[model samples]
Target: MEHPLSQFKYCPKCGSKHFNINNEKSKQCADCGFVYYFNPSSATVALILNDKKELLVCRRAKDPAKGTLDLPGGFIDMNETGEEGVAREVLEETGLKVKEAIYQFTLPNIYVYSGFPVHTLDMFFLCQVEETSHISAMDDAADAFFIPLTEIRPEDFGLGSIRQGLVKFLSALK
Candidate 1:
């Protein structure tokens, strides 16, 4: 795979061709005196358990891992808090309104998008919903449903951070 900075050949500030690598994580433009840093994007992952203790899971509709299992969450939008992002993601993907979101933990991840590895800090949350019915897979989810915790397998999750989070979550249950 190419370096993340390989695609950026010009400086964004002045559109100059003198952009050069300043460090592993940043680029500097000799002509414009501008520096750009590559930072991980913030993302959220929800671990919603129903009263029956079944976990909510979604089938991915797009690549990076299409057809694999995933949690109901995505990249946080600009100016949105992590809690708000998780709630919005749950509602968007599963049509479930989150009543509350309790932050669990975070894991670094690499989400490859369009051939570029997008670094992300994935924040996990234990979310409670106002209701569990009326679920329909929308947005990027191909399908959404609840499975008993016993049925969950970490290997079933395609995203690395998600799989690690699942293991941590399940272990904590004991």
Candidate 2:
């Protein structure tokens, strides 16, 4: 596995090669006294339970985890709250309008895109959709479907954080 900051070879502010790893979480430029701390991006995932007690899932359209089962959500947009982000992501990916979303839990995740592992703070929400009659896979999803809670398997979700999140969610219901 590659280091998260391995791609950063030069300091952005000073354009210097004197940039060195200051610590596990940061880098410092000896030439300019500039320090850069790696911070995790905030992401949201929605757990939408239908009237039949089925959970909505989508197949990822792109890599990182292409064609694998995933929850309906994505990276939160700038200036959007977690709830609002979840709502927007659900609408975009699953065509379901989220009427309400209850905060559930948060987990740290490493999302690798284009060979760079980007750390993320993933927030999971239990969501209620305004309507379930209309659902079409769009945006980042190739397909969308529902699985009964009893039939859900952790391994089905390709993302590590989503698998861990599903474990905790299932445990809480038991």
Candidate 3:
């Protein structure tokens, strides 16, 4: 619990470690008067299925959870619709465009980012892309490939979160 990123720091008014996370959007120090609110990031991800029913996964190249296999997704820029975000993420992470996308699920997740408390409200969609088109990895990805859903395992994932998402998505299919 003693990490530089815990979001817990001296209130300056009265140094205290008692911080509350239940605040509507801000954490107020129980002692002094320090307010901290996480800036929740909005993200959109695309679950693309090919003709063989294989799902496309990308190996991440960035941090927070680097070197992991994940769905095509990224932060949603201001004023951007979920559709636009997902489409852009897919295009950016993989050199392929989704032809159609259908809403699937939403998840509110929190994780430590660079030792800072951060949260994410992720919107997911099932997408269909060109089946025979050449697949290639682009931004924020080291590589990508279409693999059978059953072949994905936690050990194969570079990040635990993406592995969990894949597991959940696969479970929903069953």
Q: State which candidate has the highest TM-score.
A: 1
Which 10-residue span in candidate 2 carries the lowest summed lDDT? Answer: 1-10
Q: lDDT of each structure?
A: 0.96, 0.94, 0.74
- How are the candidates ranked when ordered by TM-score, highest leading? 1, 2, 3
Q: Model 2 — TM-score against the truth?
A: 0.95
* Model 2: residues with Cα > 4 Å off, grouped in runs: none
lDDT score, residue 165, model 3?
70
Which is better, 2 or 3, measured by TM-score? 2
Which tens-of-lDDT digit does each residue in 61-151 have in candidate 1? 9998999999999999999999999999999999999999999999999999998899999999999999898889999999999999999
How many residue pairs of model 3 clash at the backbone?
2
List candidate 1 stretches off by more than 4 Å: none
Better of 1 and 3 by lDDT: 1
lDDT of 2 by residue, 89-125 (tens): 9999989999999999999999998878989999999
Clash pairs for candidate 3: 5-115, 27-36
The digit string of per-residue lDDT tens for model 3 on 42-92 reads: 887788887778888888787767876777888899999888888888888
Tell me the lDDT of model 2 at 125.
100
